[model samples]
Target: MALGSLGLVAGALLIAASSRWLPGELPSYPPAQNAAEARPAASLAIHDARPGQPARRIAEDLIAPPPLDVAGVERIEPRPPLGELGLASPPQTPMPQDWRETLLYRPVATSSAIFEAMGRRVVISGTIDVDPDRTCAFGDAVWPCGQRARAAFNAWLRGRALKCVLPPDVDRFGVAAPCMLGKQDVGAWLVGNGWAMASPSGIYGKAEAAARGAEMGIFGPPQ
Candidate 1:
């Protein structure tokens, strides 16, 4: 019994020594699978996934372009050029009423005829008709003979109903050669007939001493 007991104790020691040497049966631990690391791989597969269903179609309604409206516009008419028309006629002016009638008339009888016919037909007598030489000789000579002669001649014209147109100059004798009576050159007729002579002084200056010195017509005896 002691030997058996010794063997049993030895067997028990071997069992204890084997247990220290050998590892326990680990609770079926799956090969340390990195589940956290596998999560990224699963997420990448979902991100790269293609659309299996038909793509959603978007509805679009395009508006048509507006039509152009050009109406009711007025057009300007062109005017004809001035050169196209003929030259314009000048405007007529009215003449004066008085200018239309004649105002002058010629005489029939000359100075000689008129003088000869004095008293009967025409009479011209005044201090004016007296020669300036005869009148100047007397200091008390009244009436300016030359001036009176012109006045008498003018008066004769008035009496005859004729215009008096006296010559520019007269002889010392106070005789006008080309005296005009109503536009009639009576003096010219007298000078032409050698009855009166041309004078150097004017009709008014015929009485001057210088004019007298000329001894023109009626100043000296009939030549």
Candidate 2:
């Protein structure tokens, strides 16, 4: 071999000799004589000697408390099919006592109601504007005004009976005359509650004034 090749071989032999791994690079450890000791050292350090046992598996209670009286516990009976009693029923829109003399009203799921009076079936004249889809600044976030109004109205009207007084005449569109719930006018209530604004004709001037003053309904009051 060339002189350079011989020098390289000698240098490598010197390194291997110093490390004591010269002739043959043997296994890291001696082979186990039995199968029981064949587990890797890493596994032995991380877990108990018991093979296949979980680390979190507890064998006994560390502190025992007084026994509970489970034997005397009352048995639960089968549930009846009557459904949830806590849930209230939906509202049934009031029907007119007399078709010719009264106005039948069915809410259109909104401030407006379906009206049938004076031999005509038509929608009531909505003298108010409720911006249900309008998003306004409320605290740190904006929220839908219409949804809140609808939910509040439905929750209040549901399960409770409502009475109204209707005028004896019909409007130009065959719509029923304006109605009122007690002394509280329907249009006035809607406006006064903040769900609606006063009509262009200012039909609910006082109601609108009250609602704006109190910051009610879909109108998020100024901060």
Candidate 3:
């Protein structure tokens, strides 16, 4: 009987010690009155509203827009074909290593002719110019050979166009250039005819020799 009473006392002491040391029951959270209140307003609105119309316009905006009305929209028209590409004027034939200029000549000396090119005056090339007043002697007779040579050259030109190869850079006056009249070289013709001497560095040496041998122009009896 005494041992049973001791046991009862020991159990009462354990209960008292635990109550003092352990934390009180956590404060009970108030029971949620409305389950909808616990949820977000947007979700609650969607759940509470009737199903016919959208519950929230903001939620409706998230849905992808209806497919584009391809059949109703207009399409762009294609561009017209471009006109055939062409130059304003006919293209000139290309020549290598030289500019081909067309010039009108007026004989100024036995070997030189004056012409205008790109608004500049130019003199013919490849010969030693002979003065218009120069006189030539064949045996005991003397003649105005320079004037005659000029006249002959002028007659040959007769206002025809000459295709000339002139320096890209030329002086204001006395611009010497090689020219062609049909198939003939003007300078070579002058030297070959003995009306003028070939320039020191010119290509008319053979023409000059031939003229000398034939005794043509100033080398022959005045003609």
| lDDT (C-alpha, whole model) for all candidates | 0.37, 0.54, 0.69
Which stretches in model 1 have alpha-carbon errors above 4 Å?
1-135, 138-143, 159-184, 188-197, 201-223
Clashing pairs in 2: 132-146
| Model 2 RMSD in angstroms | 20.4
1-223 in candidate 2: lDDT tens per residue?
6999999999999988779855466664665466546776645443234678666533335346657799988889878657544644433345476534343444334432332333444432345544456566656767777666656655544433233344444454444335554455656666777766666554565666777787676655432
True-structure RMSD for candidate 3? 22.0
- The TM-score values for the models, in the order shown, are 0.19, 0.39, 0.49
Ranking by TM-score: 3, 2, 1
- Quantify how close model 1 is to the true structure by its C-alpha RMSD in Å: 40.5
Model 3 regions lying over 4 Å from their true place? 1-100, 105-120, 168-171
Q: What range of 10 consecutive residues in model 2 has the weakest lDDT sum?
A: 108-117
Clashes of each: 7, 1, 0
lDDT of 3 by residue, 1-223 (tens): 9999999999999998878754555454795467757877756433336589756434554467877888899888987647423314323334447555655454333333444544556566667766778899999999998888877777777767677766555546556777888888888788888878877676676777889899998788888
If both were scored by TM-score, which would come out higher, candidate 2 or candidate 3?
Answer: 3
**lDDT tens readout by residue for model 1, 1-223:** 9999999999999998778654555444666657766566635322223489654433223245555465755678887667623744333233334322112233323332233222122211111233423222223334333333333344444445333322232212222122345565544433332223333332322233333465433343232
Candidate 3 residue pairs that clash = none
